[model samples]
Each structure stands twice: as structure tokens, then as C-alpha cells.
Target: MTIKVFDTHVRTKTSRYLHFDVLIEGNDTEKAQAHARQYLLEKGLTDEDIAQSECRFCHVEPGNPVVAQAISQQGYYILELQGCQED
Candidate 1:
């Protein structure tokens, strides 16, 4: 299972949280989520730690894709996905 991760600059009204979007090739939501969760765990995040982690799916169409947009806009890549929160 190959997964790609990209950084997203997510900002809300009151708070700012860094975002990492994971891109998977196939259209299996369950598998994609599992892979993402596993990746997070490998980074040393306990299940409890990422209970509130935000993840979403993207449906790309011809000529433009959400993952591509995220990478271009945010300048994030797969390597940035590794690592747990440093606090």
C-alpha cells in the first residue's frame, strides 16, 4: 500500500492546526483510513493521541486534482508525513 502525504495550511476562526493530507491510489476508504492510521501509529502516536486527528478523502477530476492542488498550494510532500507531535 503506497500512500502519499501532503501538508495543508488549515486555519479556523479561533485556532490553527497543521494539516497533513494522505493520498491513496485506490478508492477503498476503509483501506485508506487504515493505512493512514497505521502511519500515524508508526510515528509513535497512540490511538488516543490522534483521536481528534482530521482526515478526509478527495475525488479528483480531469485536468485538476485535489492532491495536486494541496501539494502545489502547500508545498508539502510524503516525507513530511512522518513523525509524531513534538511537545
Candidate 2:
């Protein structure tokens, strides 16, 4: 599985979280989601630390390159199974 990571800014009324969006490439949504959760856990993210996020395949066109570059610079494999897929 191949994946990319993007820094995401999530803000609430009280606080903000500097989270990461794990972008996975594959035809299967189930596989992608699984890979993402596992990767997060290995990086020390608890289950509560992750939120289900979706990125439309269409919008991924322009943003793909930029995301790829960022992931490369970060030096994280961004691909590994940490847990089973959730329903």
C-alpha cells in the first residue's frame, strides 16, 4: 500500500489540533481506510485521535503533487498495517 500524509488543521470552539490526513491510493476504500488507521497508530495516535476523512478523487488532481512532496520530506514510510479495518 502506498500513502501520503498531509498536515491538517482542525479547529473547534475551544482548541485546535494539528492532525494529519493519510491519503492512500488504491481502488478499495476499505483497504485505504485500514492502512490509514494503522499508520496513525504506529505514529502514536490513539483511536480517538483520528477522524474519518474523505478526499474526492477529483479534487486530488491538483493537490497530489504537493502532498507527495511533503510526504517525501517528512521521511515517514506512511504505509503499514497497525490494526484491522473498522466497520
Candidate 3:
């Protein structure tokens, strides 16, 4: 099993967004997104929220989260239909 790590975020308040990192053991991006979606559902987020959300596959050195990098270095490719949020 190849475990992939994802850094996801979503808008909660008009001016605030929540963030989380999830590690899912799977070989496909589809599986990863599904795992994240389920996790968000368990957190009380609705399907509508997930449908309107976005995701990204990021790369960073081990032990370093992308957020720890300088803002200029922290960039993400917005994946389609896959951001997670807590209600």
C-alpha cells in the first residue's frame, strides 16, 4: 500500500478557512480524494461543501510541511472537486 499525504483546506467563514493534512494509503489519486471526502463528511461537512471545494497534490521535503515554506514557495495546483471542511 502506498500511503499518500495530502494537505487540504476549505472556506469555513467568509474570511476564514480551515486546513488539515490527511494520510491515505492508496495508489490512485481518486482513492485519496475519496478518503478525504469521507473524512470531511464525518466531520459534519455536507456534500454541497465537497462539491464546491478544491484540492491539490503538493510536494515538499520530508519533515517539512508546505506551510512552513516561505509564502512565495508555497504554491498548489487546485485539484477539482476535492477540498474538505468541518461544518
**Top TM-score hit:** 3
Better of 1 and 3 by lDDT: 3
**Where is model 3 more than 4 Å wrong at Cα?**
13-16, 50-52, 60-87
TM-score of each: 0.46, 0.36, 0.49
Worst 10 residues of 1 by lDDT: 5-14
Model 3, 1-87: lDDT tens digits are 233456676664443454665544333556556655665676677666543444455543333343334222422222223333334
Q: Give me the overall lDDT of model 3.
A: 0.47
Candidates arranged by TM-score, highest first: 3, 1, 2
Task: Note the residue pairs that clash in candidate 2.
Answer: none
Q: Give the TM-score of candidate 2.
A: 0.36
List, residue by residue over 1-87, the lDDT tens digit for candidate 2.
Answer: 245333233222323233344454433445445654565456556556544443222223233565566545653323212222332
Model 1 lDDT per residue over 1-87, tens place:
233432323333333243555555445556555655665566555555543555555543332364556445643223243233444
| Worst lDDT 10-window in candidate 2 | 75-84
**Cα RMSD for candidates in order:** 8.9, 9.8, 9.8
- Judged by whole-model lDDT over C-alpha atoms, candidate 1 comes out at 0.46
